[model samples]
Structures are given as C-alpha cells and as structure tokens.
Target chain A: MKKHNYSAGPCILPQEVFEKSAQAILDFNNSGLSILEISHRSKDFVAVMDEARALVLELLNLEGKGYEVLFLGGGASLEFLMVPYNLMKVNGKAAYLDTGTWASGAIKEAKHFGETVVVASSKPENYNHIPKGYTIPSDADYFHCTSNNTIFGTQMKSFPETNIPLVCDMSSDIFSRVLDFSKFDLIYAGAQKNMGPAGATLVVVKTEILGKTGRTIPSMLDYQQHVSKESMYNTPPVFPVYASLLTLQWLKKLGGIAAIEKINDAKANLLYSEIDRNPLFKGTVAKEDRSNMNVTFLLNDEAHQEKFDSMWKAAGISGLAGHRSVGGYRASMYNALPLESVQVLVDVMQELEKNS
Target chain B: MKKHNYSAGPCILPQEVFEKSAQAILDFNNSGLSILEISHRSKDFVAVMDEARALVLELLNLEGKGYEVLFLGGGASLEFLMVPYNLMKVNGKAAYLDTGTWASGAIKEAKHFGETVVVASSKPENYNHIPKGYTIPSDADYFHCTSNNTIFGTQMKSFPETNIPLVCDMSSDIFSRVLDFSKFDLIYAGAQKNMGPAGATLVVVKTEILGKTGRTIPSMLDYQQHVSKESMYNTPPVFPVYASLLTLQWLKKLGGIAAIEKINDAKANLLYSEIDRNPLFKGTVAKEDRSNMNVTFLLNDEAHQEKFDSMWKAAGISGLAGHRSVGGYRASMYNALPLESVQVLVDVMQELEKNS
Candidate 1:
C-alpha cells in the first residue's frame, strides 16, 4: 500500500530525498563509506554541511543578508531553552505570545533566563486559534511567537512588525510557505516537519543581535560560538545534516518555497472544503486561522469515529490520529505532501458522509 | 574498493546494523512510513527506545540496578555542560581528571556552572599517558573523568574507588569492553563510536543521585525529566536512536560487550604490534596506557610522511590521518572493525618498510 503519511513531526519528506539519503547511508558520494560513518570534517561531508547551510539561506531569500544558518542537534525543544539562554539577558524582559504548546514551552524556558511577559495567549480557549491584538512592549528585550501550532492546527496569518527584536519558532510550518525573510531577527525550526529529520534544528539568526545578552552563555548554547565555528565547534549531528541537505536540494529543485506554498494551499483547501461540506465532519480551528500545514478536524457524530478511522486506514492513511490534547484527526500537509493525497482524504470524508 | 573506515566518530557500524537501519529509513517495520518520519511516541519507535535503553543496561549488567538510561541529542559536547548543570550546585565543587581534548572541554563547561578542581592531568606530557595516583576530593559534588581519550589514544585501565559520585565520558571506548557498572554513579557515551551514529548521547545515571544540586536545571538538561519521560522529553533523534537499537541488537547477538572486547583487543594488538615493529613508525602513547580503541602512532622520520599517507590511501584506508593537534596517525578500532582490516593495515606498514 502507498501510505499517506500525516505525522506531525519526524514527518514526511520527499520520496526522492528518502531514496537518496538511503543510498548515501550505503555509499555517500561514491566514497565507499556510509554517511553514517564518515567524519563530519571530511571534505565530502563538509561540502554537505556547507551546502545545507547555504541552501537554507537561499530558499529563504536571505542569502548574504547577514543572516547565518546553523544546523545544530537537540531539536526545537532544546532551542526553546537555548534561544533565551543566548538572547535574553539578566534583568531584561522578553514578550511572548502563547499560541499553543510549543509557544508555552518557549515561554517557560525564557522565564528561566530572565523576565518574560505573555502579552497574549490562546490557551484560554484550548489554543484553537492564534491569539490576536497582542501588543509588544517596547521595553521587552525581544518578542517571540510560534508561527504555527502543530497540536491545535492554528497558524498566524499575519505577523506583528515591531522594532523590538522579533523571534519566531517556525518548527511545523517552515518552508511550507513564503514569508518576508528580513523582518524577523531570529527564526528556528526542527527539520523533522517540513525540512528533513528529527535530530537537526535549523537556526537562522542575525549576527548583530547576538553577544548583547550580558549574561554568560554556555558554549554549546551560545549562538555566537556556533556561528563563528560554522556549527562545527564540536562534532555535529552529521547524518541529520546530510539528510537535511538532500531535502533542501529537493526543495530547490522543485522551485523553492514559493512553488511549494501553492501546492500546500491547494491541499489545505481541498481537505477543508470537504470538512465544511460533509455533514459528518467539522474543522477544529477558526476558518481564517486554519494551518495550511496541519489540517485538523473532528467528527460531528461521535458514533462514526471508529468507522471513519477504519475507512482512512483502509485507504492506506497513516498518522492521521490527532494529539491527545486535541482528540480528532490531523492531516499534516507538509511541503512534500502531494495534492492527490489530500484529494484521497477528501474522498474518504465524502464516503463517510454518504455511508451515514 | 571496499573502504576501511577508521574515522573517529560518525564511525563504523556493523554491516548488518547498517543494512537494517537503511531499510528502516525507507519503510520502518512495514508500517509503510519511513523511520525518518515516524513519531517517537508511536508504538514501534517506543519499542525501539525501550529495547535500546534495556539493552544498554543489559549489556552493562546494570538492569534493575537503580539506573536509568536516556537517549538525548547534542552529543557528548552538550553533555559536557549538562553533566555539571544537573549535578554541580551553585558554590559547590566538582573534581576532574584532565586526560585530553574532550575532558578539557568538559572541564571548561563545568567551570561555568560551579567551581571545578583539576585533581590530576596528563597534559604535561602532551597527554601521552593517563595520569595515575590521583586522589578525588570527597568534598566535591562528583568526580568526573573521560574513560578513553580519543585524540591522545590513552585509556584508563583502572577507575577510582571513592565515596564520591563518579561521572565518566566514555565516548570512544563504550561497548568495546566490560566495565564495573556499579562503581560509577553516571556514565555517558556519544553514540557515534562503538554504538551507532553522531546525534544521540547515551546517559546511564543512578536515579537516586539526582535532584541534590539545589539549582534549577533546564528541563532539557535535567536527567530526572528525561527518566520520567523515557528520553522523549521532546522529539528525540529518532533515526539515530533506531540505528542505535539495531547496533545494540547486533552487539547482543555477538555475545555482548565481553565477546566484542576480545575481538577489539585482538585488532588493537595486531595493529600496535606492527606499529612497534616497523622502524618507520612508533606508537605515540605510553605502552601501558595505550588505548585499545584508538591506536595513535607517528612516522619515526618526517620524510616518510607522504609515502605512508599514500600507502594507506591506496590500501583503502580512511580516517588514518591523526588529529591535527597530535600530528601523527590514529587508527580507531571500534567494535564493528574486523581484525582482518587491522591485518590489512599491518600489511601496508610492512609494504612501506619493503619500499624504503
């Protein structure tokens, strides 16, 4: 069966990326050495690291614009702590808009370093929508927000333009759309969602914004050290970086982020239209705030739950189950997901309605 | 030509483990989802996590011995900081043994968290031997040491029997030999060498020894949180963990660490014998403290450098060039390296002698 993978993270990558990565694991660049075993400092693997860092900037249209990209280990969860450790200073305050679980996580870590103010939060309504009308305090060291919420399936349609240094965690929706690259002072994403695998976290930081945090930062968590060493201050997560490079290559070959956004929009629209039209289902988040990457929905009639799950399983669907926090189905339409897969899901929804 | 990989870390894995891990990356356990895409919370990957953790304890004979195993990201470099963060309290002191680069790295990080005492060091002799007769301070929070110095090619043949907690960075020599697991309160090994790949760090900590630091450890660095969550405090490096599980399975199938130790010893003996006998080469580390995993040597005469380098390259040897700091050669013989490969390297040395 051809499986339609909708996993929230460690999520689907382009099949070509998968094939190429697998081949590299056997014989990377005809070196007769597995990518799994080659030294990160080796010329071939170093080229991979260089290409991955370069492509991240190129795809974001931020090339040579003073934005440095670092491929680091520990995923976005660690980034939650590292961001504040490196940027938030002693006695300084940072503003955070808590849209979902990840945002709250970031806020929690930021508080450990200094003062953090939650300007607004959607947690009051179970995080079903992106919080709006939040005012960034001029005194805040930086303003942080999660661009997309994977668990609740809400995405910010518009970002706040502020003089305060803007930081965004784009873990779930990075590379799935085109956005202004120059506005944010810093952006980070775990590659598992739209980029590549789970080990490497992609960090794009404006070099000027770093080293201002008066507090001493641990070497491993310091952005300045990582950027200065080009993400090789220590042995990096070599295989994940290589896999991300291959995925970035695939994204570039497919015309970069701009081209993927159109397909992503179509996939989101196709599945959302069925949810609105079918009597058996309803969309989870507010219509305008719906995530183009993760489409979440719930069955209107609880009795049809088992039947609907079986139907999707029979259709070779995988990872459609929603998070425990939000009990429903979530179809994660990352950049690599085909529109035909969304059509198949829409057909399953229509079939469920007809059966009822 | 088949490559003989001796690159220290992101180093060699068993061929069977490689095949299985590569296949899983395509379609993990017939779930029709790539291992790269599967959720860490999924039953299949959870099993991989559980089995890998269990095997660590099993191989070390520490199962049900009040120890918990965690698979984390950022490799040993991150652990260099984390070890002190979670264990060293503010105003407290920790004792350290400065063996080589990684130990010195660990010492540098530990100093940021609290006062760190270098109880002993081998740096005076260019780290050519593991320091002996060092007494650890009982007043210290913990005594830290690197079990194997990868760059200097020195291994500790004995461990301190002290009342103070002992923490070891066994990045290079883990799973290559049997050790007294109960004597140490904490043991960490980066999975790139003798384990799997270059992403996850394996931490085995005695549960009762945590939470005494009195400082708030970041959740990501806190061992308690990782133990409670079973190493899924966040989306772990899933692919690396899975690959590690496959390697552990391979290790277990080959009669665990004890059996591999014999082979590792044989391979080291075979290579070191040639290094000692060949007039053109001489071992760098002291004979008594020379590592069984990494055998460091230098050309007796600098004139033979190009000839020796080309000879190894022609014999399909990779990663034989030593670390720049050492300026010689390092042949890392991990568990997966066959004795036959060492013999091949030995033959190359003999051929160099004949050519001279």
Candidate 2:
C-alpha cells in the first residue's frame, strides 16, 4: 500500500526510480558488486556522472550556453555559503529578494561575506506573496532569489530582469514548470524536491560568472575547483547521484520537463479547483501567487479538524499536514506525484463538504 | 556472485548492509514508503538518527565522556575548511602533520585561516612512511594528524603526546582498530570506508573544546549548531546516514570494535606475510608504518605484471590497482572484507611466484 506521498522534498519519486535504484544496490549494471562498494573513479560510475551532467544541460536547453552542471553534497543549505563564497567579491555588496525562510538564510550567509541588501521583504505579511516592484542595484555583485518557497506555499511567478549575474535557488520547484533557464547566470537545487533524493544538490552555473569574486575561496567551496575536477573534487555522494540520474532518465523517457509540466499543471488545477469550490475548505496564501507544487489550505472550521484528518488518513493520504509556520494542510504535488493521487485528495475534500 | 571489493574509500561494507539497504529503498520498515521517500523529521527516521549517533559513541568507548556525534555532508574535504573555521582563532596558528595526500590537503585549507605550521612531512620520500618525533606548538590553536594514509599505504602506529587539542582525520581506517578513545579531543571520518557509503561524514567532538575560537562561523559549518539540533540543523544526507546506521548495527552485532580489530588484524597479517615471502612481490612502504587497512605492494619485475593482473582478475579480485601516485597494487581490507578474500589473494601471489 504505497499511499499518496506528499512529503515536501524527499517526496515521491517515480516508481521506476525506486525499482532500479534498489536493483543497483543489489548489483549495479550486473558488475557483481554493490553500487555502494564501487570506486567513484571506476569507468562505470564515471559514465553515470558524465551522463547525468550532460542530461541536466540537455533538459535545461543550456547545453551550448557555457553552462556546466555539478552534483554536490551538503544540500541547498551548503549552497547558501558556497554561493556567497564563489560570487561575492571582496567588499562587494549582494542584493537579495527576501521571499521566505530559505531566501533569508541565503541573505544571512551573504552578510558574512560583505554587504547584503534586502531589496524588499514580504516577511511582515508572513510571506504570503512575493515582494515586487523593488529596484535592483546595478552595482551589487549578484542578485539572488529563491524560485519557490516550500514552507510558505508562495512562489515567484516571474523573475525580475537584472544584468548583474542573476542567481536563483530552485530547491523546491526545479523542473516543475518550464522557464527560460539561461536568463540566470547561476542556479542550484537540492535534489530532494523534484529531482531525486536527499543527498545530492544540482548546480548549473555559467563558468564566466565565477573567478571574479576576488576573495580567496577555499577549494571545496570554490565552483571553479569542482568544475575543473568534474565534480569528483571529493568522492561524490555515489548512491544519491546514481538515483538522481535514474529520476532524470525517467523524466526524459516521459518527454522531458515539457511533458511533465502538463501533467503537473493538471494535478495543480484539479486540487486548486476543489479547494475553491468546497465550502468546508479555504486556501492559505495569496491566490495569484499560489505554488503549483505545494498547495497550502485550511479547514474553515476548527470543529471539523479531527474528522477531516481521519478522512484523509483513511483515504491513504500522507504528509498532508502543513508546516508548523503555515498551520494547515499542504499537498506537495511534485513531478513524480500522479494526477490520480491528487484527485483522490480532491474526492476526500468533496466528501467532507457533503457530510458537513 | 559478490566480488572481493578492494577499492579504496567507498569500499566494501557488510553484505547484510547491502541486502537490508536494498530492501529499505523498496519499502522501509513496513511503513508503506521507501526509505528514500520518508521525511528525516519523521519519527521513524529520528529514531534511526538517534540510534546511529549513540552507536558511534558506544563503539568508540566515548559514551558519557561529553562527546557528541554528527553525521554531516560535503565529505572530509569540507572538513578541511571547517576544522580551521571552528577551531582557529583570529590571528591564531595551527600545527599539522603532513603524512599523505589527504593530510597535505588539510594543511592547504588551514593556510587560508591564519598561520599553518607543518611540523613534519614525508613528501620528500613520496609519503612512503609517517613523519616521526614532531614537536607541537603549545600556543597553537590545535594539532591535526591523519590516522592512515590511504593513497601511500602508511599509518601512524602511535600518536604524539601533546597538550593542545588533538584532532585526527580517520577517513580510511575508522572503526577498524581499537584506540585510546579518550586521547583525542576531536575525530572526523568520511563514511565511505569501514562504515557505509559516501555522502555523509562522521564527526565526534568533545563539546567543551568548541566556541573558544571566537569566530562567527557560518551556520552550516558550525559544529555547535549541528550538536544543538542533534544533527538535524538542516536536511541531512538521508540515505547515506540510514545506510551507515545499518553498517553500525552490523558492527555491534559482530561484537563491536574490539571484535572487528581482531578480524582486521588477521586479514592484514595473512596478506602481508605472503607479500614478504613471495619472490615476485615486494611491499612498497616502510615495514613498521604499513597500514593495516590499505596494503600497498608491487611486482618485483614488470614482466610479471600481466600474468599477476590476469590471475587476480580471474580470481574475482576487484579494485586491486594502486593509485596513480603509488604505482603498484593496493589491497584495502576494511572491516567488511573477510580473511578468506585475503587468503585468495595470497594464494594467487604464491602461484605467480611459482610460475616465475
């Protein structure tokens, strides 16, 4: 009984990924060795690393655009420090758009490097919507933003136009929708959300944006060092990287991101429509800025809480409870979550309204 | 058939770990979810983390000694920078013993913080032996050493007596030998060897030694932050951590570190004895400093290289090729490798001697 898994990240992956990844652990490529035991420098693993890197570029349409992909460990949290270490020059200021907790975390790390300016923040309103109409300073080292806020259930529908090295952390919403990815000079995502599992992070950066920071960066934090070594700067997170490749291959087989985007849109529309029509439920964030990935909403009446909880649990719904900050139900419909699963939740929502 | 895995780090783990890890990916603990899909904050995973951390201290005989365990990402390479950031004070110096490639790498990262003094180095002799009788600066922030050099096949048989904080990088040989666990203030190891898979790193630190550097470390790099949150400061490398827990559990079932040390010693003795007795083979490193974990040796003549290579391959010996820096064969017998595998290798060496 594999329930409808809506875990925000480390969420649902394609069933095929689960099967193949398990098989690899037992015996990788029939090499008579577990994937965990093989050397990172082995020809078999080198091919996995190379193919995964190339697939990232091919899917993002950045293959010939001077973009290089790196699969790193430490999740997006480490990227907060690495981004500032590799991009913020000595005594240079960085501009950040404060959307949510993760965005503020990035700002905090950048402040350690130099001046970190918050252009505008929706924090006062509890980050229910993306802050807009903020002016970007051209003198800043780079402009940083997070594409989607997983906890707050708000997302940036449009990115601001900026010339000075546009950077984004797409940890929760990468590959969920189609975007002109080359517009940003740098992009990083923790693979847990929509890509793969929880160990590896995907970093796609334009090499030209690096090496100008002027600060003496440590080798592990320096993007150029990782680029030169082809992400083998240290022994990579082997199992995570291999599993991520399996998920990426599954996406490609289903016609890449463009095809999955349609399925995702359908899932989002079905659930959002039910939230809007049902009398017992109410949506949580601003309607226009609602995340297509994480749909946060609440039961309108407190008396219905226990009943609604039991109903969803009985209907095989898991991870529907919202984050502590947002106090409600959040259905995280990532790329691997099927439309049928979303409909099951909608039916449960409709049943609650009728019984009330 | 499972081959005799001799690859360096990211080397062999218990076969039980492999079977259980593969099963967890499909359905973890009958939770109707894959281990790869479960939330790290969930009760099931929190139990896993708590048990794993407790097991590390118990195995090291550091329990109830104010030692805290952390499973982090970025490998031991990231620790190169973090060790300096968390310990070195403003304008303070640190002393390091350069034993091999990894030891030198740690020294390189420490130079960026402040003055870094290399008390001794065996680089001139190509790291064939450990540097001895180095004086530690009492005024230095800390003293660092690597317990085993994986690439050069040399290890420190005895540690230095120092008043300063003693730190060790035990990436290649952790959990494979019994040590005076209370002697060192801090120990770190990448989990690729003798533990589990790659991605997660194990850090055991005496908490009292922290926060004296007076440096405002980044939240991710701060050991205090991880300790406070109980290693859940951020999303951890979930799969790697889980697999490591499995390996640790396997070790405890086989009577813990004291038991594994005897088996590890036996394997090393059987293989090294053959290397010394075989006319066609010679050990590469100094006799006394040879590592019990990684056994490096070479063919006495280039003519025998082809026949010996074929013999080992036919016997299902994998990853016997030495590192490029040490041009010979390296037989890494970690905790999981059996004495039977070493016997198989010794038999092949004797057969090669007979043919020659």
Candidate 3:
C-alpha cells in the first residue's frame, strides 16, 4: 500500500529524495563509501555543501543580493536563541509579533537578551488567526515573526513593513510558496518540512545585518562566524544537509517555489473545500489565515471520530492526528506531499460525512 | 577495490550499520514509509530513540547510576557552549585542562560565563601529550577535560580525581575503550568517529549535578529541559540518532566495548609498532600518550612523501592525510575499522621502506 505521509515536520520529503539518499548511504557517487562515513571536509562532501548553499540562494532568487545560506545543525528551536544572541544587543529592544507557539518561544528568548516588546499577539484567540496591523518599533534592533504556525494552522498572509531588520522563522512554510524573500533580512527554517529531514536548519541571512550588536556572541550562536566559515563553522549535520540538497534539487526540477505554490494552493483548496462544503466537518483556523501547508479541521459531530479515523487509516493516510494541543485532524501537505494525497484525504473526509 | 577509510571523525562505521540504515531510509520497519518521512513522535521512531538511549547507558555501564543520555544536535561544538550555560553559575569559576583545540574552544566559551582556570596545558608542545598532575580547584563549579584529542593524536590515560562535577569532551574516543564511566559527571561526544554520523551528539550527564547553576539557561541549552522531555526536547536529529542506534546495536552484538577495545588495541598496536620500528617513518606523539583511535606519524624524509602518498592511494587507503595543523599522515582506526585495514597500511609502510 502507498502510504500518504503528512507527518508534521520531519515530515514528507519527495519519494526521489528517499531513493537517492538511500542509494547514497549504500554508495555515494560510486566512491565506494557510505555517505554516513565520509568526512565533511572531503572534496565530495564539500561539493555537496557548496551546491546546497548555492541552490538555496538560487531557489530563493536571493543570489547576488548579499545573502548567505547556511545549513546548520540544531532545529529552529536553537535559532530562537541564536537570533537573539546574534541580533539583540545589550540594553537594546526587540519587537516581535507573536502568532503562535514558535513566535512566542522566540519572544521568550529575546526577552533574556534585553527588553522584548510584543507588538501584538493572537494568543487570546488561541492563535487561530495571524495577528494583523502590529506596530513595529522603529528604534528596535530587529522585528521577528513566525511565518507559519504548524500547531495552530495559521500563517501570516501579509508581512508588516518595517524599517528595522526583518527576521522570520519560516520553518513550516519555507520553499512552499513564492515570496519576495529579499524583504526579510534573516530567514530560518528547520529542514524537516518542505525541505529535507530533521537534523539541519536552513539559515539565509543578508550579510549587512550582522555584527552590529555590541554584545559578545558565542561562536555557535554567532551568524557572522557561521557565514564566514560557509556554514562549516563546526562539523555540520552532514546527512541532513545532503538530503536537503536532494530535496531542493527535486523542488527546482519541479519548477521552483512558483510552480509548487500553485500545486500547494490546489491541494489546500481541495481539502479545505471538502471541510467547508461537507456538513459533518469544519475548519479549525480562521479562513483568511489558514495555512496552505498544514490544514486543520474538526469533525462537526464528535461521535464520528472513531469512524473518521478508521476511514483515513484505511485510505493509507498517516500522521493525520492533530497535535495534542489542538484536538482535530491536521493534514500537513508540505512541498513533497502530492496533490493526489490531499485528494485521498478529502475523499476520506467526504466518505465520513456520508457515513455520518 | 575495498577502501580502508581512515578519515578522522565522520570517518568509518560498521558495514551492517550502513546497510540497515539505508534499508530503513527506503522502508522503515516495512512500514512503507521512509524513516526520513516519519514523525519523530511515531511509535517506531520513539522506540528507536528509547532503545538508543538505553543502549548508551547499558554499554557504558551507567544504567541505574542516575545518568541521563541525550542524543542532541549541533555537534559537540554546540555542547561546548551548552556545558557552560547549564553548569557554570553566574559568579562561579570553572577548572579546565587545556589539551588541544577543542579544549581551548570550550575554555573560551566558559570564560564568557565566569572565571575559567586552565590548570595545565600541553599546547606549548603542539598538544603532543595530555597535561598531567593538574590540580583541579576545589571551589570550581566543574572540572573539564578532553578524553581524546583527534587532531594531535593524544588521549588522556587517567582523569584527575575531583569532587567537583567532571566534564569531558570525548568526541573522538567514546565507546572505543572501557572506562569507569561514572568517574565523569558529564560526557559529550560528537557522533562521527567511534559512534555513528556527524549530525548528532551523545550527552551522558549525571542527573544530580544539574540545576545548581545560578544563571538562567536558555530552553534549548538546558540539560534539565532535555532530560525531562526524554531528549525529544525538540525534534532531535532523527537520522543521525537512528544511525547511532544501529551502530550501538552492532557494538553490543560484537560484545560491547570490552570486546571492541581488544580489537581496537590490536589495530593501534599493529600500526603504532610499525611507525616506531619502520626506518622510513616516525610516530608524532609521546609513546605513552599515543591515541588508539588516531595514530599520527611523519615521514623520516619529506622527499619520499610523494611516493608514499601514491602507494597508499594505490593500496585503497583513503583519508590518511593528517589534519592541516599536524601535517603528515594519520590513520584513524575507530572501532568499526577492522584490524586488517591497519595491516594493509602497515604493509604499505613496509613497502615504502623497502623502496627507500
């Protein structure tokens, strides 16, 4: 049976990524060495690192724009700390738009550095919608926001214009849509969703924004140190970086984010339409702020829960269970998740409605 | 041709680990989903994380010793910063043994927290030997050292007895030999050399020694947070952790460290003896302080370097070049490296001597 994996990050990557990465583990480029056993500094792996960094810039259309791409270890959770350490200065203020869990986490870390001002938050409404019309402090060191909230199924439809440096945690939505990426001074995403596997985080930063903070930053957390070393600041998570390159290559071959955005839109529309149209189901997030990558919906009648789950399981849908915080089903349709898989999920949802 | 990989960390792993991990990537446990695509919270991966953590304790004989094993990302370099963040108090001091580059790196990070005392150092001699007879400060929050120096090919034969929390970075030597693992309160190793791959790090720390630091640690760098959450504090580097588990399983199947240590000793002895006896080459470090994992040697005559390099390449020996700082030849015979591979290199050395 073909499994439609909608696993939330560490989520579905392309099938070709699976095949090629598996083959690389067996024999990397016919070098007779497992990719797992090769040195990060070797010519072969260096080529991989270089190509991956270059490809990330090329795909984002940020090449020749003072952007440096780094495939670093530790997830976006670490970035929450690094962002503050690298950008936030002693006695300086940072403005943050708290959209969901991750954004709040970043805000929490930023507070440790200095004064962190939450411009606005949708936490009162249980983060069902992206906070809008948030004021940005002109004197703040930087403005930070989460582009998409996987747990709440909310995404920022439009970013706030600000004079301060823009930093966004696009962990769940990066490479899944087309955006004027150059607007953000710094962007980071864990390579689990719409990228690669779980071990590495993708950081794209404009070089001009770093090193202005007066405080001394630790080497691992310093963006300037990582950029200077070309992301090999320490032995990077080699496998994750390689797998991400494979995924980015797969994405490029499928016509970059512009093409994938259309497909993603179609997938999100199909499932959301079924939820909205069907009498037994309804969407959890606000309509306007709904995430195209992760679709959250609830059964109108709680009595049909068991039956709906069984139907989806029978249809080979995996990772449909919503996060514990949110009680409902979450279909994470990342870049690698095909439109047909979303159709399968929609059909299951429709079948449940008919049975109910 | 069979390649004998002697690349220092991210070097060689067991053949079975390669095959099994590759298979898992394609179809994990016959679940019809690549391990790369599965959720870290899924039962299958959870079981892997649990087993890997347990095996680390069991192999090190640290189970029931109040030691918690955490498989984290960001490598040992990240752990360098994390150690101080979690262990060093705001006004407290730390005692360190400056063995080599990594040790100095750790000391540099520790200085940012509070007073860091380098009790002794072998760096003046190019890190050719581990500093001995160092008196750890009784008032220090913790005593730190590197168990093995990969770059300089040196290993600590004995640890200083200290009442203070003992921390060691065993990035290149963990799991290769049997030791009184409880002697150290915290042990961290980047999983690339004797362990698994380059993405994950193994941190074994005694639970009782934590939370004493007065400084508020960031959530990502907090040991208590990771332990409380069972090392899934955030989505861990799944693939590296999983591969590390497979390598650990292979080690256990081969009768754990005691069994592998004998083989490791044999491989080291065979190669080191040749470096000492052969007229064409000489060992780098002091005889008593030589590392079993990495054997560094230099040619007696630099003019024969070209001929010797070609000979080894032809013999299918790869990654034998020493680190740039210690430019010569280094045969990194980790646990997974068969004794026969060492023999092949020794044979090449004999050939070089005859030709000379």
Task: Give each candidate's interface RMSD in Å.
Answer: 1.0, 0.7, 0.9
List where candidate 1 sits over 4 angstroms from the true fold: none
lDDT of 1 by residue, A1-356 (tens): 65888888878888988789888888888888888998888899888889999999999999888999999998898988988888887888899999999999998888788899999998989999987887899988899999999999999999998998899999999988999978999999998988888899999999999998788888999899999999998888888898898899998999999899988988888888888988888998899999998888999889999999999899988899989999988899888788888888888888888888
**Alpha-carbon deviation at B6 in model 1, angstroms:** 1.6
Question: lDDT (CA) for every model shown?
Answer: 0.90, 0.94, 0.92
**A206-325 per-residue lDDT for model 3 (tens digits):** 999899889888888999999999899899999999999999999999999999999999998898888889999889889999999888888888999999888989999899999888
DockQ of each: 0.82, 0.88, 0.86
* Residue A199 lDDT (model 3): 95
- i-RMSD of model 3 (Å, 1 decimal): 0.9
The local lDDT score (0 to 100) that residue B254 gets in candidate 3 is 98
Question: Considering only N, C-alpha and C atoms within 3 Å, which residue pairs clash in candidate 2?
Answer: none
Ten contiguous residues with the weakest lDDT in model 2 chain B = B272-281
By how many angstroms RMSD does model 2 differ from the true structure?
0.7
lDDT of 1: 0.90
> Pairs clashing in candidate 3?
none
